[model samples]
Target: MSNIAYLGIFGPGPNSSAAIVSDNEIIAWAEEERFNRIKTSPNAYPAQSIAFCVKEARKLGLEVTSIGYAWDCNSYSELATANLEQTIAKYPSETDHISRLAQQGLNALYNPTKVKQDLGLILRKLGIELTDQNFKFYSHHLSHVASAIYTSGFDEAVVIVNDGVGEVASSSLVYVDKQGTMKELATEELPNTLGGFYATITEFLGFKAYVDEGKTMGLAAYGAPDADIMAVFDEMVQTDGKSFHYTVDPRFRYSGKRTFGSRFTDLMVEKLGPSRPADVSAMIAPYPAIAYAAQKKLEEVLFAQMKYAASLNLSKNICFAGGVHMNCKANGLLAESDLYENYFFQPAASDNGVCLGAAFLAKIDETGEIPKLPSLEHLYYGPSFTDDEIENVLKQCKLEYVKSDNIGRDVAQHIAKNDIVGWFQGRMEVGARALGGRSILANPLNPDARDHVNRHVKNREAWRPFCPSLKKESFQGYFDTVIDKSPFMIVATRIHKEFLDVLPSCIHVDGTVRPQTVNKDINPLYWSVMNEFEKITGQSIIVNTSFNVQGEPIVMRPEEAIRCFYGSGIDVLAIGSFLVKKGRR
Candidate 1:
């Protein structure tokens, strides 16, 4: 009998994606939003994304035999149905007409049979017949653990998954042995969720809850963490040696609601002073202090949990996953503290990458043995274009582009002259952070480059810091702490005192920099441009930001890249081997 192939799907929320795998390899993986031009969460099922994965598998002449859903709807059947009923019961008397209708919609969304019907429809669109035996469901948190620990290449490690409510758990701690067996040590269930708490604070601080947490993180640098504010959080969220608990404040508790209720904002005002207004210019005095306090309290509680996990597992290696790990500053603090000898956070740590986790776990169940999977060295796992695809888009737009045999050197030359370059190369990346594939490259040496990109090109909050793409070899020279291996842009580290002014564009106000170290082997073309930039200037760092503007998804095609180049203040566009100047056509 031949080994079974698995197709993984993540849907019913944003970051809908699909992953296809044979017995031996991950044939392809992609987020539906990448193709559909949506941001993190999409409401529909991953039909288009599954189609892409199926097409990729067909191209490789592999047949998919099993389908995996990252979320276990059955696991949440009782709890979810109960929660929906409670909401509906309270709706008529306590809720308005609009609120009552919304709860009615939630009733249908949480129905287990509705989930199966949606899955069937999604499978049919992908040309796969849905069958009970052919499909398997994995717990959401377990899928996250599998994604991190399996790809970590660690023989044994402790795994931690932290995100918004998944089924009933908000945080989970498990131990994976040398043979890849997972043992659930403990879990902190809903209403006590760290992710939900952080998101509430995020919304209170005048930003989109799930989406703008990064902005609040950046703003933390400007204020001091107030003891009073920290005490408030400490009172609400408690951590023991082995397990953690949250004493829910009815004003601000996680009920698995899509949006935080008004009581959440009211509590923030009562505890931390008035919440920050949404008007960007109104960002003033106490807001930064509140952000600082929230961030510090979060780190304190989270690190305690990590320490408990470390004590129980007795492993030097740790595999961290979920949206919380996206806090690069906190990750940097952990890396600097020497808690773990090795730390692994997958490139797509959020819900988007759980598709890979589901597929890997399904593969293990089918074979009854852990396959020898290769460590992930690169994240170029999405769609790629051919030379003809590139030229055809250019021709369709009637734009003149010059094909270059040496695009790396030419693009480097433009950057050296302080020109902003839109770089689109190879396959699109599968995460929030843009690596080399879809990025905006600028000279880190330019004193004005950070403001130029933030204000002119990205039109984002000016205080938000830009990241540096540094040559891996130069890691020792630039940073105080010798963290030579951060490829995912998920870890923040301190900049050397001497190099702070030198790389001002990439350094945050707090003197920390989130750097993605580049190597020649993983991304040769991107590395070539960095090499040439370093040759021109003594610095081996370049300001690397995502290719998209503040509110848009990253550019997915050559035509989108071209449109962005012309729309923004960018001077040059480099897609494949072709180069187009903003006004040269």
Candidate 2:
């Protein structure tokens, strides 16, 4: 361990979360927004995030040897241009340079210089001197490929990673071996992504282009597709059911600026009809048929592409990571496809996993053997608060609390009784999906559980459905397929109709549900809750939601959870050894 050569550091966005890994194990991680809370400029770098990582590592008694930044974007401009030109020429435009988008300032958003300065500032804060060694830059798409392969636990797999854009490529297909050797089969660079097309559509619909595509995915479940719009989409993006692509016209909406406009809105309206205002609560199952249609089209193209990639390496398997893969619905489509016998999607499919992916890929090249100590289960990869640490905070606040003997089982009993319980166990989760560690638990079988949870802990829109976390054995009776074990809520599956009546709140109005299947092997604490719920209700499951109310990030710390609990109308709040009920203080 002392002779370890480097630490791989990756950030999904200059504005986003950071992750660090050594010897293929994640050591320290944090989101940039948590430390600053400003949602500020990426140009400022993630110094606060860096400081947390360094400080957290020091506590673990390990000095980071080498730091790896997730991108080598030196040729970003030239590459984006060439890729966009190809898309434009093949699509509606005829030009070499598509849009005159400027990324000069964007490049500096969370740049490497800022990271080093932030790292130095942290050491200085601890009264230590700066060192000559600095963070190293790794290629961006390669990080995506690495994340897909390394975490995938596949010796050989066909890796396909597609996102809006990376430092260099937008979509890359790599053939990888267990020994960590990767061969690139294809690279579809920027302005040529199907993902980008949806992003533009997202922006035109009055949402943030990059951040709001999930909204589009959600919206798509409601509408039917416009035949004409589908035709245009198909015309621009050509797919042979193996290789799929669309060339983006640089003009009209090229610069990644003017993220919203009436022109594209009018174009979509001209083809797909007017866009529906997203009153998330009132949307009928088929009301937004256009969204459904678009989703169907996107899945058709994406599934074909996956099959194509699978066909590329019939002898190997398939693995993936990227923003587009976050579409659990699309993943269901691909997972059900006959192209690959096995599937793995990076839990942090978005940019956040790039750091660990890049670092792990580099590490694999160094030792050719995986270190088996740290597993990727549960993603308890962020900061943790100790009993003493939490105790001091409660003492400082002069708040009274109950110290429970068995935190997991005691809380599980409350949930089994159909009580909504706010649970804060250990380290904060790193990715988008909240897996038990920082979550609210409730009875999934209670048809009114959704309404109660919404009215109480979440205040979520009615049209939005609550997902469930089920114990492993109990899944078979409620769900049609438990073979995949989608513990991350990545794939939304249709529940058995007979059981839907029993768990209406857990089942979407459409009869589909996304569930996290918890086994003792995956999450022991989460499993305890499910097991207890079964002992009481004759079923083992609970409705789970990210542990924050509407319009807030998931509460990360004990204090945040405590504050939110008091602020909102929550029933119970449990943090580590302490328990607080409504006004229990």
For candidate 2, lDDT tens digit of each residue in 1-585? Answer: 442533455543543555555554567766665556433123434566666766666666656555566777455545555655555465443222324334444445445566556656754774444454444567777887777677766667788787877864778878876555678887776656656766766765545566656666766665666666557566545666656444544343353223235324334444444444555332543335545655776687678667667666544578778878888778876776666677887777777677666567556555566533322455777777898988888788778889988877788777766677888888887766778878887777677778877776677554567788887767777777634577678887888878877877777656778788787876787788778777777777678888877656677777888887877766777888788776534
User: Model 1, 1-585: lDDT tens per residue?
Assistant: 244468888886767888877875777888877777777646867777788888888877777777778887775666655654554454322333443465456556656578778888877876778777777888889989988887787878888888876776788888888888899887876556777777887887877777778888899898886778778777656665344444333344422232334425344465676566666442487788777877887787678878777766468988888887788888787777677888888778888878888988888876676755666677787889988999999999999889999998999999999999999999888888989999999988888999999988999888889998878888888888846677879999998899887877889999999888888888989989988888889777899999999878899888789888888888889999999987643
Report the poorest 10 consecutive residues by lDDT, candidate 2.
93-102
lDDT of the structure predicted as candidate 1:
0.79
Instruction: Return the TM-score for candidate 1, rounded to 2 decimals.
Output: 0.93
Model 2 residue-pair collision total:
17
Best by lDDT: 1
- TM-scores for candidates 1 onward, in order: 0.93, 0.87
